[model samples]
Target chain A: MRRPDHQTTTLTAEAVLAPYLREQAASFLRGLRLQREHSAPADAGTQRADEAARALRHAARRISGTLHTFRGALEPVWADQLRAELAWLSGTLAREHAYATRLGRLLDALHQLSGASLPAARPPSGEGASETDKERAALGVGAARAGALLERRLTLARTRAHSAALQALGSSRFHAVADAVALLASEVPLSPSAAEPAGLVLHAPAELAEQRMLDAVAALPPDEAVEPYNEAHDALWHQARQLLRLHRYAHELLRGAPDPALVGPGHALDLHRDAAEAAAAASAAARTPRIAPATAYALGVLHADQRHEVEAARGVFRETWPHAAAVTAS
Target chain B: MRRPDHQTTTLTAEAVLAPYLREQAASFLRGLRLQREHSAPADAGTQRADEAARALRHAARRISGTLHTFRGALEPVWADQLRAELAWLSGTLAREHAYATRLGRLLDALHQLSGASLPAARPPSGEGASETDKERAALGVGAARAGALLERRLTLARTRAHSAALQALGSSRFHAVADAVALLASEVPLSPSAAEPAGLVLHAPAELAEQRMLDAVAALPPDEAVEPYNEAHDALWHQARQLLRLHRYAHELLRGAPDPALVGPGHALDLHRDAAEAAAAASAAARTPRIAPATAYALGVLHADQRHEVEAARGVFRETWPHAAAVTAS
Candidate 1:
């Protein structure tokens, strides 16, 4: 889904609210487009269908994040009710998004890293060149086999996620979320406090949202305690990652006056989350109750790899952290 | 060591030969410096020593590759024997480089991916900002523990490689190789065929080398036959990768006038080797005799990842191979 279009001449509460609602509606329409081709069943195999599913989830998340940040600006009861419904639609779309994106990402990585040999472009000249070119193309026997395996399993996962998404879309609860979002564009319910002044309503919440993010970061366990070996530390880092995410979404609502601190710093925590997940996967692989020695060794290699990553990330954080930078600059 | 320095006043066989030996000697001296810092035994914990070990291995490989490429330029008996010795030295250093580089690369990825929030720049113009900054820095406790685990394991591997390298240096066999290389600079024994004309010496084998590389590529199984599901297919890809490697070495002997078809197209095969090895590692992990289902699943995932990489490399080869370019340029 697109970011909220805040290029309105007026920056009222309703104006800001309209853009957010429009963003959600745009995503909902995209999801509907995915299922329009078939009468009875939905097919997830189409690349456009997959993109629509991801777009729908992204829209739901942004709507929910905006609600959390600016609940005070809107009518409390209506805002709370729509927030719950948005969360449901988001959950419905999440599984499909996760599986589809993961498969897409892995395939992309393989393409990048497989390391292509010199690409044999067609020569404008003679026929002998084309004959050998064809002969050389015949030698890429291993790639075709590998592609088939990934397509089967990943497609299955994507289809299953899509089927679940289709079922959720047909449900009454989802329709209710759609209706609420549709109403938001024209008949937005703003609180008395927000109705009185345009500047106070938008700017205060933006600043508070940034403040809350900092508070969340402060609550996380200190770096010295988040040692790579400590199991407890990953949980803390995970919490920090979540908080950083919330901060990012909060800033997205105020995209016009962007806050670099609120958005980009969260990216650093993305690595922390990845390292933790990788370590956890390795651990699960290792602790596979009655694990094989070879499996255990492989798990060891993976664990070591991720743990090393955790350290490297921490080193980078220490180097680039704005707090550290501020201290050095001062 | 650096690749051969070909920007020369006179590109004679010995002129080219002298630079290669000097490059290897420079790398050797650097390794010796690492060990000499201590009166006692070598310690792998020193980052400098680890760097030296890797440098030495790189130097050895280039020397060995060059020896293979231009064996005709020197005495047949001397060249073949010294090539073998250089390979032994290279193999010893390879173990350490492989482990160290892998650990380093993985760690770098973690840093890139970890999503950190609030890159705290210069603390706000207040006392409270500094307080929180100090508090936040203390929170990265998990990374330290993980770092320690990787350090201990990687350092041990590095130390073991260094010890092996040191022992080889002291042996009479290595001394013989060193003496042979030293003699190469001054009293070089040249084959009569090579001594005749400098132009003939370089060109004949280069052409032969290119032809051999092409023959090897042609020998590999066609793309349709190589399926990921069949274990037999992986073996064929492995053989192709080896031939590509030999071809790359052959061309390193004539780096002054590079054959793009010769040098780069082999990189496609480099990924093939990596994928094969990764798959082998995963297979070993899977076959851990009485393997647990979880361990087996993890190994399966790892295997699938590498197998996918193999397919990607093949796809790339099919696209980029410069067969048409070679003929068109000619």
Candidate 2:
């Protein structure tokens, strides 16, 4: 599939995707170099290098997958064009591995020179020079030779210009792989919540998110009760919403869309059945509100000092104190 | 000078300074250990170790200078207390260095083991039967050996928790020396615009600091012009202020009060004279408005279409047009 020249186009996805890929690749390569330099020679060094290589490969695969996905979404002609481009990229990667092998040799040579005593022996010069002069001249020659070799290799590859393309492919592949891996690694069994049958239940990996929710609730000031408590409640609601979104996305990807039969024969035909049920439940919950102690204290303060309705405020205080105490103990 | 209590009653200055000195010592020792392990040959390794030692000594001297500065600020009795604590710290550093030499030898032995191929001998009695088990067993042995040696040393120095103190002192010293060396090595001549007119300038070696500033600026939104420009202006103001503070502090230490003669006449009474001048300049620059095409277009869109203030919006557009054109041309 190839995109028609006349098709409405903003920024080409490749234009955005290319630089992003290249940056990720460059960062990964730099990290690899640093690890190679700093890590002590041990089984750990080998293990670390293997892990890094695995990560790089995973990243490359992700980029390839993303390109494929984008191609699938494009018009038939454009899809074919993108697929062809990806095919070319895969071919280039094969050749690039050869270049990497040569680069490895160059690196090894550089490492050797670094380890060698400074003022290395002069390359066979016919001149009868003093030892000091010979040493100084040799040092200059060795440095120049290294620089020239590196420059020639770089020029051969047109590395400065082509690096961007290499980077883009690598990064996209990485992200695709990472996303797939995360999906596969998730262990929680999906289920429907009892309180809200329409809502998908999530078993949190740990109590950390829940603990943060509790702390936020406890930290609310007595004087500014409702707003603070509501903010925390909202935060928890959002966290729950995120879990729902993830569950929906995962379910869609894994098992296609929701089955109409699950909601019952007639219910599936009703377009707003799920929405109406959810809203009704929410409104009922809102009517029978759970008041917390901080809420009570805030109401008390408002009544006593801020000249709010005394009897109404006292009623709210009495209702909320038990929940507030329970929340504080937790 | 000995503190009267001998064990306690030292000033807060001495407490802070003692830890700083100890950290410097510990850092120096760690660097020495790293050098000994990494350096290829005995002679070269010794030279590197000696260099690290020299750096530690230089840091120790700086700590002594700071102590003297503290002494000048405190009462005579407190000054005596600080001096005693400083002397004890300096003595501790010397002793710590001796222990570090022994530690370096052990590290060197471990470094050799990392590079060595395992001997094709029968597995030791404690070695495991399975391949995975053997690996685990070897690791356990290595850990046990290291731990035992460390514990033995700690036990021997149980009199005053001398081993822990020494280790802490060595680590601290190494860090201080490394930091000072980094500062000295990386220092670059500040641009005239960034330089302070008077007072000590604490800089993170110009290249690193400049890179950090540039990174921060680059991370800002391209259209959000206020923050990037303001940050540069603020940093200059901050630098000037710091210099002024240091000058005042130094002057206070040197003399009972700031010297009017050194500062000069009426205008010199203000310690932050340079910083105030820079801040005023920055403030004036910020207030000096620049009209851009985008700004004019945004204003026109907001007032003309949204607010329906055609006449007022036209006036603004006309006023800004020339400056906008000038900006575009540039």
Best by DockQ: 1
Question: Residue B151, candidate 2: how far off, in angstroms?
Answer: 6.0
How is the predicted docking of candidate 2 categorized under the CAPRI scheme?
incorrect
Error of 1 at A68 (Å): 1.3
lDDT of 2 by residue, B1-330 (tens): 222222221233333334344544465445545544533334432666457545655454444443344333224354354345545554554454444443443333333322233322222232222432332233234323432443345334332334443454457654554454344233311223223311122111222323333343333223311111111222332332333333333333222243233233212212222222222221221122342222211111111111111122222323332222112101
User: After superposition, which runs of candidate 1 have C-alpha atoms over 4 Å from their true positions?
Assistant: A1-59, A107-160, A214-330, B1-330
Give the alpha carbon lDDT tens digit for every residue of A29-69 in model 2.
54344434433334322656445544444344333433333
lDDT per prediction? 0.53, 0.32
**Residue B77's lDDT in candidate 2:** 56
- Indicate the fraction of true inter-chain contacts that candidate 2 also forms: 0.00
TM-score for model 2? 0.18
lDDT of 1 by residue, B166-243 (tens): 687678987786676666544556566554443446555555555655565565556741234233344455555555
lDDT of 1 by residue, A23-135 (tens): 66667656655544431344444666656666666666767767777788878898888888888777767766555554554344233222244323333234434433332
